[model samples]
Target: MSSAVSNQARPAEAGPARQPVPGPASTGTGTSGAGASGPGPGGRGPATDYSGYPLVGSKHPWRWVGTAAVALGVAAVAWSLATNPRWEWGVVAQWFTAQSVVNGLLETLKLTAISGILGFVLGFILALMRLSASPLLVSVSWTFSWIFRSTPLLVQMLLWYNLGYLYEKISLGIPFTDVRFFEVQTTTLISQFAAAVLGLTLNQAAYSAEIIRGGILSVDQGQLEAAAALGIPAWRRSTRIVLPQAMRAILPTAFNEIIGLVKGTSIVYVLAYSELFYTVQVIYNRTQQVLPLLLVATLWYVVITSVLSVFQYYIERHYSKGAVRTLPLTPLQKARKFFATHAVAPSRARSPR
Candidate 1:
């Protein structure tokens, strides 16, 4: 009886048992307070905070400083050039559009066009020969490329100009038939312009052959096999399939060569062919305005090269089909888009009532 009374007394003395309250189930609503309608603490909800995962706020102060420094340097140089009287800006303007200069410009363009066409055509044939199965053809192509490329273009030009010294006559006829169809004095056959074209074309063709070969090699061997499997004729396979693809690789370097050829036309000054550079020399010799004349030539070259570069950009874009998902915007398009995006005025925030 006493033990039972003691147990009852112990129960009466002890406090009430506390029961655990169940937390709310996550609703992915990023709230976890009373009704789960607001952020819980530290402005973050019960859901794990990943807002700071990709950490920001890293700064590189030197980049801005360097950019500003470069801009200032360029501006300074430009200003100095503009103000310097030694440049003889007046003389540059005077002869910039002279008739002789214009004629020289035309001649330069002519040489570039003819040389580029002939060189590329011959180069294409040489490339084909290099890729041919016949040992004799390969050897001949290799030897031609080797000889032309190894010799200085200036030397070649000189040699062609003086061809009369080596061979008085050039003949075209059936070999060993004593039936000459045509014969001409070497000097008469090769005028200064003709010699320049021959030299430029031969030199350009040698380098262009290597470039073409490289482009052809860049195409996958599997592509050739596939074309062959389809029973495509060799010519058709090369021209239709392989060459089209190879052009993507070829165009950039080929354009570079063309531009070089444009500049290379200047070397014909040695033969006294009156291209742009030669024209400049003639004017400078008369006027003794060396700096201005040189500047004129430099500016013309820059303009021509710039135009070619622009053309190259468009051609490259044309050939980049299927290679890139989206074409890049033109400068005009980019400028228009930039102004459209940035020219708008921002809305002003209203004060709270």
Candidate 2:
């Protein structure tokens, strides 16, 4: 009882219990010293002997099946194209770069360039008008878009071509006076080219206005307000802050519209203008090689659209800088990655021991 009482009464030893004297192993100091962890040399975990096991890749059976099916379909289409005699591929090759066709192509390009530039410029102004505080500007913008967009493009082209029936003369003169600065007969003034340009430009403007307005609206109002609060001038704020952000939203749709316009130039054929489609029609009508001539036009259109698509991709990539951490890979980059991964893997697997 006294021993127990003395043991209990004694003050506890200070700090921790006495530790074992550290040897080479515990101190990890000597060349041959091994730690208590029993790990590989240099404290790494044991080296796994993966060479003994064969790797089994994850199964994607459905994916393989889908790929096989698509390959077969593509092969069938290619075979059909090869064997079909009605395609008259020789005629297509012959006339593809003929002088007449080239001239028509130039005309088509001219129309597209002029109409696209004028349409977008007018549309930008109309978009501003639509978004303005004044009721008159908004109403005028709305009415113009409504009338143009609601009517068929074909009708507009016809109406513009036939404007002479409604007005004997077109003039720039005083509102209610005989004095005139310029005057021309309506029939002469609204020739085929002039009428086609007028119709396409107006129609394009109507759609472009909406596209621009939507893009502008997509920009956050808070940013604009913040810019204003920070005393950034309205013009600077619009050009610098709003436009840059809004373009990201606008570009994809805008490119689609432009592409559509390229095809839409076909409608100008009704006016008997010498655009690509009209030229093709004339050739086919004369030679009776309808399919081949049409094929030539189709190929040219495909080439144009493909080029535009490339431009669209690069432009979008440029604008995506702030939106994405990494820019999306280009087709060339993707191809390189694909080959590197698959080709390297197969070669590595077949490598000698």
Candidate 3:
């Protein structure tokens, strides 16, 4: 009777057992749940959906309209130029490759080559002098650059051409010395071509000196210090380390100057040196085909400048290797990529049913 009463009391004290809580993954609601269709580990959400869907691109109506407008404008200009007889396209073709024109072109190239070399060399020396520790050297360099840059190039050329009037003879000798050195007539020495070269080189050197100096200054001070610490000779440090790096800054401006120099050769026409422009002027004078001759000169200048620009682009690309992680695509590569991206494959023709 006591044991039966104890069992009844224990049954009355006991409560109902608890159920286990459902996890997010099991319930299909959290990151790992069945309903989650993403790109997460268990296909969590819409991100992981690989079902086929048609690709759609954004519309750019304005871009198409602008391109069409440009095309129409270009077409209209081309039509006008083609129909205009005043342009004398026939005459342009006639004299485009004439012997006189070819000779003039050669003269222009010769002037450009010689003047460019001399100008850059003198400019480099002036730049070094300007940057030197010696006050005398720096002052002299500064004064030379200042005077040449301040004066008009045309005036300088004219002055050089007429140098004989101011000084009948040029002599190389010690001042106040009875000892004689060779003396030459100023007029004989300062010919039209010589005057042109002197004027162009002096003027170009002034500008180029500043450009080179700016380039040199662009190099980091630490580079110079590091080279010095390494016990590298001054000349070696300058040529091998500093200048190679500085060229990255210098080449663009230098090439612009060169292009300008090519055209600046025309200024020598004032001295009666028969460069391309002078040749063109002479032809137009004889034929009275002024516009056509002028056009020929313009076209040749354009071609020469274009070639230099292309050369500049490649040179700039070469120097840019260390500055950019990846080089830019060449024109040909860019064109290929553009066509590949825009090309559409033709749809297959359906067979007759």
- lDDT by residue for model 3 (1-353), tens: 23333444443222210101222333343323223332344433444232332222334668878989999999999998899999999999988899999999999999999999999999999999999999999999999999999999999999999999999999988889965588999999999999999999999999999999999999999999999999999999999889988999999999999999999999999999999999999999999999999999999999999999999999999988788899999998999986675555323222111
Q: For every model in order, what is the number of clashing pairs?
A: 0, 0, 5
Q: Give TM per candidate.
A: 0.82, 0.80, 0.80
RMSD of each: 15.8, 16.0, 17.3
Tens-digit per-residue lDDT, 1-353, candidate 2: 13333343333311111111333344353222123333433555554233422333334668878989999999999999988998888999999999999898888888888888888889988999999999999999999999999999999999999999999999999999999999999999999999999999999999999999999999989999999999999999989999888889889988998899988988999999999999999999999999999999999889889999999999999888788998889999999887777786785544333
Best by TM-score: 1
Question: Total clashes, candidate 2?
Answer: 0
Each prediction's Cα lDDT score? Answer: 0.84, 0.84, 0.85
Q: Pick the lDDT winner.
A: 3
Clashing pairs in 3: 36-44, 37-44, 37-45, 38-44, 38-45
**Candidate 3: 10-residue stretch with minimal lDDT:** 12-21
Regions of candidate 1 where Cα sits further than 4 Å from its true position: 1-57, 339-353
lDDT of 2 at 167: 94
TM-score of 1: 0.82
* TM-score for candidate 3: 0.80
